[model samples]
Target: MAFAAACAAVLAAGTAPASAQAEPALTYIWPVHGTIVDHFRPPAHEYGPGNRGLEFATQPGSSFWAAARGVVSFAGPVGGRLHVTVSHPDGLRVSYSGVAGIGVKRGERVHQGQLLGTTADRLHVGVRRGEVYLDPVLIFDGDASTGVRPPLSRPRLVPASTSVYRLQLRWLHSGAGIAVL
Candidate 1:
């Protein structure tokens, strides 16, 4: 294949092996340009009723795009609303409800801002990591004027102290030990 040949040529020139490809980023944007009518409400209990996603007030038949790049997990009518669930590579699933029509099918990969469906009376956006429903506003900057697209911020990592070092030791049968840093 052309990719294999390219790697071979790079290696033959006394260069290092190609670096591992990175996973696609979790970029999210406003799926539709509308006023935020209802914000996400946390549930009182595990089975208590609560708003899991944000609801936008958009006109009927307005096109709604995907908030992030992911694979379509579900696309169909549920509870009298056309719902579409996209599973991101990071194990987070975003669900859109109150859509009129779905442009993407189940198992289809969608890019950020890709058209997913037509908005109905109300567009609901829900996010869940496993069974926990998260606040959708946490991903947005809260400053999207006229729905201007802005790349979502990546998750931050906990800072580590420079003087702190944790080591793992594994003993081998050859009377040697390996120290993993």
Candidate 2:
């Protein structure tokens, strides 16, 4: 009787369905082809202690790719740079800022590594999971193995739903804010 009960229990646990035990892990690709100069630092600028993001120091007109597949939520000018943000279905958001111009629009679907925009020395990039913003460096898997040690550490993530912060950008080229949404 004991052996039968143990076997039943194991079967029940294993057959419950894999979806219930799955955790969503959203990963993004490198937004631009430039080397990472400035990483996501919450306190590096005037955004106070919890504004996390990265700045890609690249040349002007370099293509910016979608880090992951997502839906474009907000695409416009902020801090004098062309910015585009894609909200994934898994509750993660990826942002591309400091670009020369945007190729995606609000409410459009974007694939992984899709052409979203172009970056420059002034381009800023970021990723957020739920209300918590993560260090952009943590998502890059090849950096440490490739002998490129990132200077940033994993921050104690805080709720980012209310933290609608902005980066004070230095533009690479002048442009106006135009949108489809």
Candidate 3:
């Protein structure tokens, strides 16, 4: 019947072939272990005076890391202060300012927790999704008070055979009382 065919089509569209499925969203970690000295404060207008990112109070020469796996988009001085920026796969650009010792270079691929540079007395971290700046506190998954990000969670993988069987079982149990084609 058309109704059954429509239902089957809808169900089929819900589950893509495993190879076509997207990977899980990337989880971000803290770039450095330090106490948060300042939080994000959005400006009233463009070029207005307001802190666009989080500031951490850390010891000079303390190592900082990439928040997530990404390519180094920039590593150089900005306004006389050293800075490093990583462009993530999710289109996020994370910038670390006030760094003293640089380790990664521009266009280089970096993994999560990989050392990018060392910070000075304070570290300024900024995140941007395109041109709009985002708060780093909300991006990283961890406790801001402890200044440590926990390990990333492992994704559960389901075998193709078992997944298909489970989907068929679900369809049958839905009271349609019809076997999937």
For model 2, residues 104-181, the per-residue Cα lDDT tens digits are 889999877677877766777777877667776666532322445334443322222222222212121224433212
Q: What does candidate 1's lDDT look like per residue over 1-181, in tens digits?
A: 9999999988888754457456655656667777788988888998888898899999999888877788999999886768999998777788999888889999999887778889888899998879988877765533222444334453422222343324322333224566433
- Pairs in steric clash, model 3: none
Model 3 regions more than 4 Å off: 1-21, 142-181
Q: lDDT of all the models against the reference?
A: 0.76, 0.68, 0.84
> Ten consecutive residues with minimal summed lDDT in candidate 3?
151-160
RMSD of each: 20.0, 14.2, 16.7
Please list the residue runs of candidate 1 whose C-alpha ends up more than 4 Å from where it truly belongs after superposition: 1-19, 141-181
- Which lDDT tens digits does candidate 3 get at residues 67-126? 889999999998899999999988889999989999989999998888898999999999
lDDT, residue 7, candidate 1: 93
* Per-candidate TM-score against the hidden true structure: 0.67, 0.59, 0.67
- Let me know the TM-score candidate 2 reaches against the reference structure: 0.59
Ranking by lDDT: 3, 1, 2
Off by over 4 Å in 2: 1-26, 44-51, 141-181
